[model samples]
Target: MKIFKERHFFRLVIVLLLVSMASCNKKKNSYTAVSELDKKTFASTQLIPDDHFLGDASCKTCHAKEHDYWQGSHHDKAMQVATDSTVLGNFNGIEYKSQGVKSRFYKEGSAYFVNTEGPDGKYHDYKIEYTFGVTPLQQYIVKFPNGRFQCLRTAWDTKKHKWFDLYPDFKVVHSEWLHWSRGGLNWNNMCADCHSTNVRKNYDEATHGYDTKYALINVNCEACHGPGKDHVEAARSLGKDYKGNGDLKMTSQTKPKALVDACARCHMRREQISEYYNFEGSMLDHYFPQLIVENVYYPDGQILDEDYVYGSFVQSKMYHNDVTCTNCHDPHSLKLKFEGNKLCAQCHVPETYDTPKHHFHPTGTESSKCINCHMAGRYYMGNDFRRDHSFRIPRPDQSLKYDTPNACVQCHKDKDNQWAWEAYVKLYGKPKHKHFSDLLAPGLRGEAGGLNHLLELAKDTIYPEIARASAVNVMTNYADPQVIDNLLHFLKDESPLVRGASLDVLGEINAADYVNYLLPLLEDEKRSVRVKAFFALGSLDEALIPEPYKAVYKKVKKEFETNLKVTSDFVGGKVKQGNYYLKQGKLLDAIASYEAALEIDNTNNIARTNLANLYYRNGDFANAEQAFKTIITQEPEYGQTYYSYGLLLAELNRVEDAIVQMELAIKYMPDNIRPYYNLSLLYDKANQLNKAESTALKGFKKSPQDESMLYILAYIYSKNNEVEKAKNIAKRLVDLYPNNSNYRAFYNQLNAVQ
Candidate 1:
């Protein structure tokens, strides 16, 4: 998976380099033209007809069995107005205390209420508006003015039958957006889209309000199929004589891709293009799924955060074999097609896979369950346990080597990875096939041969698009010529994921010379692709864009702006807007965007950190310092904040204070080599030879292949009268960069020294 490294670290390093040396135009002619800009043919744009959503009720007459099966299912009961029957929580004036806050859930005259601290940190009697989810846990939703509905942090565990806090350990302040009264926990913006059918978040960015609308209160028949108006019309015209296919455009068993797209619309963590989603065309045209990035997924593509199922399922061999969501899951009831191991037996021979000999465990135990080894479960939302849909084998060997979590070790807490590894080989023997994680884990961490392996993986068509995209993104850390070439090549990849991820890397590199290459993507079929291209072109000079591409850029730019505004109700959207404005050199607009994000979510560290950097960019040092100080006070362990603050302090000539911050950054981020390089330089400037030499040597030890670090270490060693060490380091640099005369001359001089 692509690791989201701290951008400030790169900014610091780049600032130290001469601008001309890092100029994109230096080798512009070296790249060959792949092809002329060809306008892509997109899927036909179709809007839902008026009164299109007939809801699940309309399907009852003909599809009685399907309709009956859907009733009282998880999807059917996803959202419900709080009532005597629907509510599962205790509402008898029971007070629950968590994180020093006392909340009382009670009932009065058929009304359900919760007395809890609201946005202002004062107790308020908030009426329970709705019940969200019907599973291991169920949360209550409270409505506020301006069309906002927030899900309570405390939910009733249906299994345990007790109220529990989702974030039991964190003391969330009332002013924080995560405190349930704010945007982070807002049901209308975040949860409503997935929970209901045909939901529209009519957000007004100007007013910061949502006039949300929905066709159905819960997931229904039309949610899986397209809007039913056209189908209904065709069926009525036939009048009980419809013997043919009825020529309905709605997704069905015939269209596997469309069906998966329909399921992924809600099942994936994605950014939606419009208020409405359809079961036609590419899902990428309307929504951009979250890539296998850090925090969201482990480097080995295991579930880390609440990714739902789409991302993991797409990586599985079953998906490549054209296994749609409906293959395993019953579409209407949202349950497995068969009980227990029977699901696997449908695909694999029962004699080979469903026996004790294959499973290596006694029959009828949890360990013998197919899901226990292949589809490992992770506990989420305090009580819910969601299994990984990737269906990968347990690799305890990888767990030991790469420090990645393994299903075997996860279940066998009393046993170590070595024991699990030995047991695995003893039972099933060594792995016969290479997994994507083997390359991905090392590539993402910048370990030995990472750059080449990632580049190869990105270009390999056989791997999943998500893994390939991740490989392209991991190339960003290397900043090599081959990385740039590979990234540009991926822009033309068939999958939208690869193309979009390539654009992300392009934006970071500021590839001004690739303006022509990026311009054509503005008119790409997918909205996600177009949006990524627009952002990638943020660094390109507007005037330099050819006249033919100007109109297209303007249209896509507006689309991108509208996309940002659609999610402006959340802090993340504001941060994206801030980044866009900042890239476009709209200082005031960027400042306003960041400030607005902070206003919505007071404890948003990312927004605060970026705001501080912007203040420093605008030469407002006092505010920058204050912002950094606030972050330090709020999150002392955050290494990126300290690293950025150290850079800011150094820029302002507070060398002594900067050194302290740099030390803290290193203390928090030991693996990062930037702090060591800068700290060594700082110590040298302060005339502390021993500290400078030691720090330089430490950086060199950490990154032996890093040319800059090697040069610094060589210089430091020479200064400290360590001629042999200097010669050895300089010789390695010369060997690495044989064409560079400076390195060769430096090596010769060091070698000649006594």
Candidate 2:
């Protein structure tokens, strides 16, 4: 099986690369340009018909060999409606229990179904409408008429020889904003755009629904190959003139940038702007570029947050050395393009790498695999797993400090980092490498503990750009005037990625001096660097910097406009317009814009979030809560969403629900003192005086200088009749924000009560 998979991968690589090389000339031919330009001039060009979209079915006629190969690939079964042949789990009445909650899965003839407890604690039998995958685990879906579907925690019981609930006891609450009733787990909109062929999510924001159209569902070949209508029509007209090479000859195969754009669509960890975008379009136009940070990754660029495939790859030395995705992966089969040791031997010769002398492992041992020591496995969620793609050396030193698993200890799970480190040292004999370890050692060991080492590393060119960028993040935790100075220097760094990273750190400091330093970088050559600089300036003082940097801001603004012009004229444009209206405080305008934007792309969480905030401000708590819930479901890691949701829950008198949301907010963002302070207020309102006092104290301890916590503590103490303590804290708050009427009012009240 492995050998066959490898051979398939190699053939895919050869075909894809050859196609890419052939289409390397990105400049459009005169005739092609004239044709496109002419189409643009004709207003009534009919805008292409939906039926023109030929799903994967059409490709089978000319590319029989490739189509057959893909039929057995995982990509083929990536998503399907739940049925006897497609479903792989044991659905013959299997039951499982977790946390005292019971769930049952069973099949009736060809239909699969699961009986599980809902969030409200009632047993319900939901029919499994779709099956998601055929792998270590598969997800089942339950559909609704609104073109929304919920991914049931329950999965097919393939091994158990019966149907089993994947989420036996876990309860997932429905948020107003989530579309959980459409196609179920058919990968309709959420996972389909990148995985399948041309997918169009025809959503209607007014009705809060999707079009009940079959054409919009599933992956299609034209998705990656551009509009196959043109190619197909040409093939029919020219007959023998067109070559049917059984390769991915889509538009993306024409150029390196185009190929990278298509592959990165799914492989990279990025923030999506539009709900959907075309494969031939630029990635930056629709997605926010990911950085090496705690939110997206560990400081060391190891996977910490989510499975962002492209982000990890960009940080690797291999990427810098001109390695492309097609070099290893076959686009058609979506599998590795080479087999066994031979695959690794493509770049690493057997003369240098095949022996135990290089790998230091016995022949045929599990560790003998090329990826075992280099690409460590990291578990995401509780079940979904992935391996690091950065292709970095294992850092045993960091593994010991952060308890982050290292590649060395991962394969040798029983061994400690020390054991692995000693073995590595004995074999390699302390060879020098450019890693952040030298700078991180001091902070990791709790020695020489300010931002000194971090600042030095940020200024050092000897370290890799990614490592230096990582150091900027650590500096923010212990930011000082000197650290800010170092960051200013980084703004001028040659690498736009590094400059962008520096701006992020500068934003964290909230320093006026650093904001001034970033004004010039807004005009940097790279669009990413310019975007980061603008966002950083917005964070520092949005009102003030706009005028001073107006000239450069206008230039960068055009990049966004250009992106909108070239890309699909749908969700992307509406989202940018909505955000613009939002930042300008045109609430009604923003709402209308978001409504329009949602019509183009209902899965856009940012639009939903902003709309929710607008609803909350208008006292429409029900709608506000729903929007927040949708944001949470789509992106649980967005800590602030929970914080906002908790506030609305409190207003609705859902104290328990509010508390849970606030706790989740704290879990994701421990450094933010606001959630802790808000949680304490809820405790105080509930008359849990001791808990309220403790929670408030915890916030104060985390941010001793924060006046809000001080005020909250004083209020709690005053309510408890502890006048002396209340007066002291209130007096301190008055000194902090003297002009504030609320603090003075609280101070006087405390003094009088005393």
Candidate 3:
């Protein structure tokens, strides 16, 4: 395997207790004792059965100040009916065109409508059911059949007061995934959970329709605080001096992590484990936060995707020191507590970070602003720019080596990384950041002890848990026994992210020997941990599971089924469903699942890829070839299709064709070693001795301990009359694997030849 930390729960629990004590002292007169008040409304994490969501209007009576501040905030305007007052776009029969799509915005009898390309590849009038978001841009929603609400690819630039295409560069046909009418634009699946309060996506698996409901049409007081009926009733019945809050989660009453976790429920690129927000347990219980991985994040841990904030925030010194969303942003208004450098000066000394000597730029300039340097951001949703919350200092040195973006180069686009480095060092001295970037950048390339270097990063407690989890995620590339052993140590890791990640990698490698080691996690305190355990072990043969573990497995299997159900609408989820079926010897079911996924979106290459793989497995080589060909036609650059097609060709003894396909695979997936290894054998089979030696040697440079590559290289050298070179390699093979009789024979044979 080119594959694969510390518990922080106790420390957090202590912090929570201390913060709770301090909270009571901080608001002694207004609220009752935290314990006394909480007992009646909350039984552990669950609210009383009678409790219901009391809408935002009910909250205004008691929290007038908060309500006033929140009235026009992003949360309040997140979603709304397309009425004249609520709609921000100039929908006056204006036609906007992009990517061969001509969309017209207009109104018909007090109803907002868009004459745009829909699912049928023809123009149709779609009534704008709702407007999504408010500032920089606003997307219109059109309710389609099967209870699907699709967000329009045509959006209004609220600031520029003009219409624009979200993806201007690409041509989208009706059959493609990114088409406005497809599942990619689905509001019920992607947008609703975050935008509304108390949302329940009642999706029918059989019908493929949704009966989505929300207590509030937009994010409101109860959205973050949970259902407010308990709080409202308690305040009304128990009076101002009452000991407890009505079991409603007030951000003011909670500690920083709790408050941040509440906000992170929506403000994260997380995997949804449950259908609705339950207002229970830790953030991990409700959602699994995205680990900092390639594509999503740069090697230096800067945001490269729409990570929301929690993924980046958790990796920051601020989050490590218990700073939270409300520390900089007002909980109610969702605006900065202070403008410019003042916000940073809340903890940092103003003279140290805010002065010209430190920043080296003129005051009030974009370069001089603290956020411009420390919180480098990129535009998302076309124009809505979101800064990274990791609070890292600019490291142009890393940028020079790693190609990661730095604030210095972001503003001074004309300047190269060298210029940025020189300027930075001249002002601030050599940057001494002890963060994991140094370890991670090279680790990603698997250079200089590769997986070992990553293991060191994962084990080192100084790095954030999210970073550690990312290290675990990347370990999938390296599949070594030693790496698997090192990874097993994390099964009992303190953080759920770390623990869940351990299960994920172990399952990927199919470390069946460690399945016993993973059973305890099935009963873990966190829902994410338990869910991961089920996912890892769910497809196993029942005989592999010990009798002692069966009862727990039986219980978790139900949760596992629910897990499948909740995500069945997703292409990734369907891929997972197919895998489970394949593992359980249910071939037809697996094929059906993958085929159904393609029905949802024909452009879903993963589903199509899985179908091709199944076809190959079932001796339907012609069908498999056709499937791979179709995929290559649809996505010419997709490397996996070429690699898979090469394997099928090799299996069918089409060596010349296989060689061509494998060479293409190497071209597209350069980092993947399997292609190089396979191509080397193909050359040897064709009696191309020099080409075989060259290919195997190149692959050996990447994975030095690869036995097969080494053996092939030795055989090629020996055949080509390079006896001394062959002997040297044979000696290494014997030294590395002394127990292998073939290696011993090869070494002796080489010695006799020399």
Q: Best by lDDT, which number?
A: 1
- Error at 646, model 3, angstroms: 1.7
Encode model 1's per-residue lDDT on 1-754: one tens digit a residue.
0111121100000000001111121221111212223223333223343276787777787789989889989889889999999999999999999998889999999999999989899999999989988888899999888888889888999999999988788787887666778766777776877788766677777776779877788777776664665455556667677543432333354566566665676777776554345443467766777777667788888988777788898888888888888888887887889988888888899888878989878888888889989999788778888899998998998888777778888888999999999999999899989888877888887777888888777778888888888888777767578878777788899988999999977876565778878988987877778887988888677787889888878767766775676667666677777777767779988989999878776777888998998898899999999999999998899988888998998998888888899899989998789888888877877778899888888878887788878988888888889899898889889888999999999888887776
Candidate 3's residue-wise lDDT over 108-197, tens digit each? 888999897778888899899999988888888899888989899888898899988776776778887667787777888777878887
lDDT of 1: 0.77
Candidate 3 regions with alpha-carbon error over 4 angstroms: 1-51, 239-246, 539-550, 666-673, 683-710, 717-741, 751-754
Q: TM-scores, in order shown?
A: 0.89, 0.63, 0.88
- State the C-alpha lDDT per candidate: 0.77, 0.61, 0.76
| lDDT tens readout by residue for model 2, 1-754 | 0000110011000000011111222322221222332232211111223564676667788978878777756667766877778878766787776555566878777788878765346678888877776665667777655676566545544444444444344443332222122222223444545544444445554565655333434444555554455556556766887674332344433555456645666666444433334321245434545555544566466777554567677667766666777778776786888866767777888878877989888877777877777777665423446778788778776666666667887777799999977887888866487565557445433354636776677677665565666676566665356766677878888755568678766654454556668788766644455655655554343446558677567655554443333222244445545555554556677677767756544556766777888887777777888888878877889899999889888988888888899989999998899999999999887888888888898899998878789988998888888899889898889898899998999788777762
Give the residue spans of candidate 2 off by over 4 A.
Answer: 1-49, 107-110, 157-189, 202-216, 243-261, 380-385, 436-475, 481-754
- Worst 10-residue lDDT window for candidate 1 reads 9-18
Instruction: Kindly report the root-mean-square deviation of model 2 from the true structure over all alpha carbons.
Output: 9.9
